[model samples]
Target: MYGLEQYLLSMIYHYRYWGLFTVLSFGMIGVPVPDEFIMAFSGFQTSIGHMNFVKTLFFASLGSFVGMNLSYWIGRSLGIPFLHRIAPFLHMNENKIRRAEGWFQRFGDRLIVIGYFFPGFRHFVAYFSGMSELNYARYTILSGIGALLWSTTFITLGNLLGTHWQGIIALLHRYLSRGGIILALFVGIIYLYTSNRNKAKTHEE
Candidate 1:
């Protein structure tokens, strides 16, 4: 396990931006690569002048966008059967899948915007969004925002921490879930407020 991680790190060191992109894209597809660690490492690279911050963030976001959309389309086209067959291979558990579905039920489409902060949640949420037949354009917009927010949060941390990033990485992962929940609820509240206001306006007219 450690060897694979070291190899991935070496890849990032040698190949720079593309390596980071490839890792994040496959990680989104449930490839077992360490997505957050690599992203933070990429940020560290930027600090050392091995990579450009803008380019790294752009590619990381783009990779996640591509991989997630692929998952969405796969779930939409093949439905549950493909996920059932591949779930074992991909290590996707029922509890996690069910949890994601429940969040979708409770939060509606807002989960897609902040799901990226919760590690594997983003993967399953994308599939649920497609299976639930959420509009593609809407999904894309939320996923894009998620990908950007996720990239910026971790990569910036990595860049800022420099040598100490590894120590705080685990803490970030631990706390990020709570932060995501708060943000999701905040967005949900705003959405509800706006929707109610619009309805009231229409009724008044």
Candidate 2:
């Protein structure tokens, strides 16, 4: 996981869209990959004429959506019985699952969408949503919207920052463990604000 940037850059340099999709899919599956950095770096590549912007966004969103749903299905199919059987080995228990369920209840469906922005949260959101028996329709809608907002933010940052993305990403990586949720919230706000502005412009036009 450490010193991954060099390898990620190389993969992006070679595989392009396929590389983007593969990395993010696994990252969301709990692999220790720098997903944000990958998207941002892809954006940087797009800005420099090394990749296509629309494709980057498309694949990034697609990879995340697929990965998240996969996690959800695993939880759903595996169900509680399986987890309970394995819990002791994994150091998880019914108590912990119930506690997480409480948080989900308080937050409700919003977690599906917002979870994408918060790194580790996304994986848990999908898995728990399934374990909690959340409706597939609601899960898809919330998760899709969240994935779009999350992917576009970092991708746009990459494009806008261009050559300077690495410095910003380096700074972000340093603070991510502490400020991840805060940063996710900030990005979500930006996404909402941008969407509103665009809607207003369309209305005016």
Candidate 3:
């Protein structure tokens, strides 16, 4: 993680706004860069007088918004074909996409917000949002708000924690991993229950 922190610091030190923006833009598009860590580090820089707080916030928010919209556009344009092409890499298949579609119909908006908090999985939210053809206006509104909130929260923490930011990042990563597992299990249980209830209703009818 020290290596990651140094890499991010180097990017910010060398390229300033463009570096941060570029990394986040691509990171959100599924590149392997540490997006949240970079954001938080930018905050840490701000705390140390290396970066302007307002500009860092603006660029981070913009990068996140644009990257997500790009994903959405890709999903809208390519639709299932895109998913089919990339699904293998994502460990997604037709059945999973269909299942996700059902959940999107039921809880799409909330997922957009929740997705921001989940690493790895958040990369797919914009694409799935596009494929699902969620209400465009709402997608924009919700995703925009989510990006702002997500970026701000981490950035502020980085600023507040300063030198201790890395510790928090490590801790947060562990909690997020554990939380993701619990959330997945919960979602699976609900899905099974819903499927069974639907099956029973169909039989009764």
Candidate 4:
């Protein structure tokens, strides 16, 4: 097994619930944890009667919520300077941040809830929300909603898929990765088109 996977598996093997929480919490703070795989694995544990699904969901949700808060506070405190230094580690860059900002401006706070399914997007939007000074109460409410939904969906999926969970999840991960890339390209195209059109109108005027 890969070192990262080994570490993740070791954590759960030794500590169970706490391990789940820790991995997910670190993940939201920009650690490269395959959180869905872990959560689903936990769900598979439930199938084998090794873990309780409700408790698993609870721990996972709590961890995700806590991590989201941590990400927000980091952005709130350090702002753009922190992101500049750490963005590379988190697989982010100026263009992604700009796109996130554009989405935030166009969609408002709802993106915080909707972004959970979009992998790296949720992380960026959380940080952006912090930098933008979104109200803490609203961010928490939305974050909680997102955390619960994300946890429940994946964990439950793991339970239902049983032994085949890993294969399907790996496939799903590939699709989500491709979808994220395609979505980025699509958005970039639209942004360029709009900017060029606006410039044309400005020149005419």
Q: Which lDDT tens digits does candidate 3 get at residues 148-187?
A: 8888988898899999997898689778767766766776
Candidate 4 accuracy as TM-score = 0.81
Whichever of 2 and 4 has more lDDT, that candidate is 4
Q: Single out the weakest 10-residue window by summed lDDT for candidate 4.
A: 99-108
Candidate 2's C-alpha lDDT? 0.80
Query: Which segments of candidate 3 are over 4 A away from where they belong?
Result: 1-5, 81-99
Worst 10 residues of 1 by lDDT: 96-105
Q: In terms of lDDT, which candidate is strongest?
A: 4
Q: Order the candidates by lDDT, highest first — what do you get?
A: 4, 3, 1, 2
Identify the candidate with maximal TM-score: 3
Which ranking of candidates, highest TM-score first? 3, 4, 2, 1
Candidate scoring better on TM-score of 2 and 3: 3
* lDDT score for residue 81 of model 2: 73
Q: Write the per-residue lDDT of candidate 2 for residues 1-205, one digit (tens) a residue.
A: 6568689778987999999999888888888888889999999999999999999999999888888888888888987777688889978778665644554554547767756766676777788777777788888888788878889999999999988998897787566655656755664475456556756998999
List model 4 lDDT by residue over 112-174, tens digit each.
876777678778778878876678898999999999999998899999999999999889877
CA error at residue 123 for candidate 4, angstroms: 1.3
